[model samples]
Target: MELAVFLLRLLVGILAFPVYLLHFLGFWSNICKKLFPPSMVVFSAIYNHQTSSKKREHFTNLQKFAGPSGKLSLLELGCGTGANFKFYPPGCRVTCVDPNPNFEKFLIKSVAESRHLQFERFVVAPGEDMHQVADGSVDVVVTTTVLCSVKDQEQVIKEVRRVLRPGGAFCFWEHVIAKPSTWTYFWQQVFHPLWFLLFGGCNLTRESWKTIEQAGFSQLQLQHVQTSPILGLVRPHIIGYAVK
Candidate 1:
């Protein structure tokens, strides 16, 4: 019975790892919106759940800050599957970019199926290397849980600033390394190598907030909201807006 149980677990791992790796490598970026529909649903549910009291308070505050209106031209970098489609106002035009060509397939399908919002265009190229996108063309650029994986983090932030028009907002929610926690640091140092290898280039120990600041974000407002209840391995979140 023990051997049978072990075999079952191994089989599940074998099947799951390849799928996980494909998504991580952005190899499946095109089909990702459809391939991970269930995960998209789950993430949407979580975001929607934040509509309650405490979460709603935070949401309302962010909404005011976001200035959601018809005139805003938004750009989402590494917009995996367009999970935040519901966040934008209906008439606000959005442009989505992902480095991997795979995003074209999945994002196109997801965008077509969704009723309310529509993207102005979906491009396949690294947003950080924004030669393809015209300069000062964007009103706002957003990234979520994506900065940790980029190979050239600084370059990307500079690109975000470049693409955004004057007075444009760049918003993000990213997980970064925590300070004064030696134990968590040690674990992150150890696990990050393997994690990066298997799950794309995501390192948990990056100082993403500082990176954003250094990338010429002149008007910056930051929020370090805690994600985990436990002491160690807390995903100290960086959420806020930076303006060019």
Candidate 2:
């Protein structure tokens, strides 16, 4: 069994050599920036279809957080293709941040289609270093399925806290590692390297919920959910809000 597992992993590494070469030559990032958006659209469609009900359940209460101006300033990190735009409260102003500029066109198209949201602007920056966004400026900070791909989860959480106003909310729904005893966990551990290469740095086994909980949010309401088996290794998710 051990030898079989080792041979399977070796085969995966051999098949992933082209992508590894691209990374070694510093071309993988550019290629991913160009290709990932369109691929993400197809993935998003399937993923959103499976998770929409839970998303609606989590997002419907955002209106209660609106201030006296009756408008919530929302900043979304890693807002790829603006998939969550339709779930936001009507008339809420939304600023988007993403590292890949190639996603801007698709994101703009999504914004145009989402008439309920007021499109603020899109900043090309990673979640870890959103220096363009001001401190304590937004009523809410949101992230969905983003932390697993980020270079620094701790810094990104720190930045999330920095941008949120007093009493503001941080909403998140992210896939996490499966239980240690599961077959899914075994596969996730085995294929993580090849998966990371193919998916542009997304890890299969990040326990991102722990980072969110340790970020010192004044109040947190989080729940672990198991989604469709179609998601395979990434079927377990953590979803909820935390007040800063």
The global C-alpha lDDT for each of the candidates, from Candidate 1 onward, is 0.67, 0.89
* lDDT of candidate 1 at residue 98, scale 0 to 100: 80
What lDDT is obtained when candidate 2 is compared to the true structure? 0.89
**Candidate 1 wrongly placed segments (more than 4 Å):** 1-70, 228-234
Q: Per-candidate TM vs. native?
A: 0.72, 0.95
Minimum summed lDDT over a 10-residue window in model 2 is located at 1-10
Q: Residue 227 CA error for candidate 2 (Å)?
A: 1.2
> What RMSD does each model have against the real structure?
7.1, 1.5
Q: Report the CA-based lDDT of candidate 1 relative to the real structure.
A: 0.67
Model 2 CA deviation exceeding 4 Å by range = 1-5
Write model 1 residue lDDT over 1-244, tens digit each, in one string.
4454456545655666875677678775455534444454555456445432433333233323334353667788988777666666555678888875545665777787666665788877775686888888887888876898788898898898888778788878777887644555555554554455444455778888888877776788888876544423435678888888
- How far out, in Å, is residue 187 in model 1? 2.7
Total clashing pairs in model 1 = 5
